[model samples]
Target: MVSHGFSAIRYETEVKTNGLSSVLMAKCQGCHQKFKFETSPQLLNNRNKSKHYDVNVRAVWGSMATRGGLAHLNESLATLNSPGMSQQTYTTIEQEIGNMWGEVVEEDLLKAGAEERKIAMEKGQFHEGVPCITVICDGGGVKEHTNIHTMRLEGYANSKGTLPTQHVCYKNWDESSQAMESNIILEGFLKAET
Candidate 1:
């Protein structure tokens, strides 16, 4: 009788790239067993139920943090002889970052409002059973008042030693920038009323 230890061995490799990181998947031809080797860890993207390479997210984040956009990122990648992501992928990541920023800003605003309310209550700063707080409004232009582009409103307790908290911000482009300050301030006050 003759015994054969193994019949044959064959394998195939597939590479998946996400920005700078890659996953190399190897499969056995005979047994169809697959194994994945990753160059970097993956992050779970809760918005789309997808996994993103950590390096990809980091690259996008670094670009945004420095006020750079997709073009700049691509330029840098090109300089390094690396393939860059498509515009669609950059936009998707940008949108995700914007959503996360909005959530964080909202949470901070709520906490600040609660703190202001507490301070007002402690200082007996109430009118007709309603808490009374003071708000500061500011507006700035790119160069002149005619070029006004952004407006900000902040709220603080009436008592001294209380820090101000940002409540609302508006960026105007459609209407005349001159009137943006008044309009945004009014809107901020109206929102605070509720």
Candidate 2:
């Protein structure tokens, strides 16, 4: 016997009459029986007719991903939805349940990121007058506001213009870990030639 999961159900006429009572209807996997369950109005509204999962919101999320790290995603989104920008309507930033960001969007973003990195690398390359690309590597540690120690290695290339070409970072949990991370970054830079 195949145990298929419950299929989604749509309520047609009773939506307004029931205060949108029933959110889901599903068929049992084992017995193949159908059932409907009452859910919270919030859940029903958010799941059935969510403004958060629309295309424009998704496009904004993609924009946020390109701007920086995930830590800043919500902050940037909130700023975008501030009073001045409220008329634009980018308020909903919640991830949909069981929904994945599709590969088409992901692939497009990945390609764009790769292109940006390539352009930055090209910009870092030495132009005329300088015989060779001046490769500079440095590593250091910083104590963050959260009191966590983080170590990072920065690589720069100079010709006519000086630009950072690479960055590697890791948590410095202990002295030994910090040493190991620094050595790894140093080795990586040494292995790469401009």
lDDT of 2 by residue, 1-194 (tens): 33345344433232221211234565655455766654432322344575332333544456444643332444554676621122123323323321334446667856864665566577775345322333333434522211111121122234335553333233334444335545654664465343
- In Å, residue 157's CA in model 1 sits off its true spot by 46
Candidate 2 regions with alpha-carbon error over 4 angstroms: 1-47, 53-59, 67-94, 97-100, 103-194
How well is each residue in 13-49 modelled by candidate 1, as lDDT tens digits? Answer: 5477766777777665566777888888988977788
Q: Rate the local accuracy (lDDT) of all candidates.
A: 0.66, 0.40
Q: Candidate 1 regions off by >4 Å?
A: 1-14, 25-35, 138-185
Candidate 2 has an lDDT of 0.40
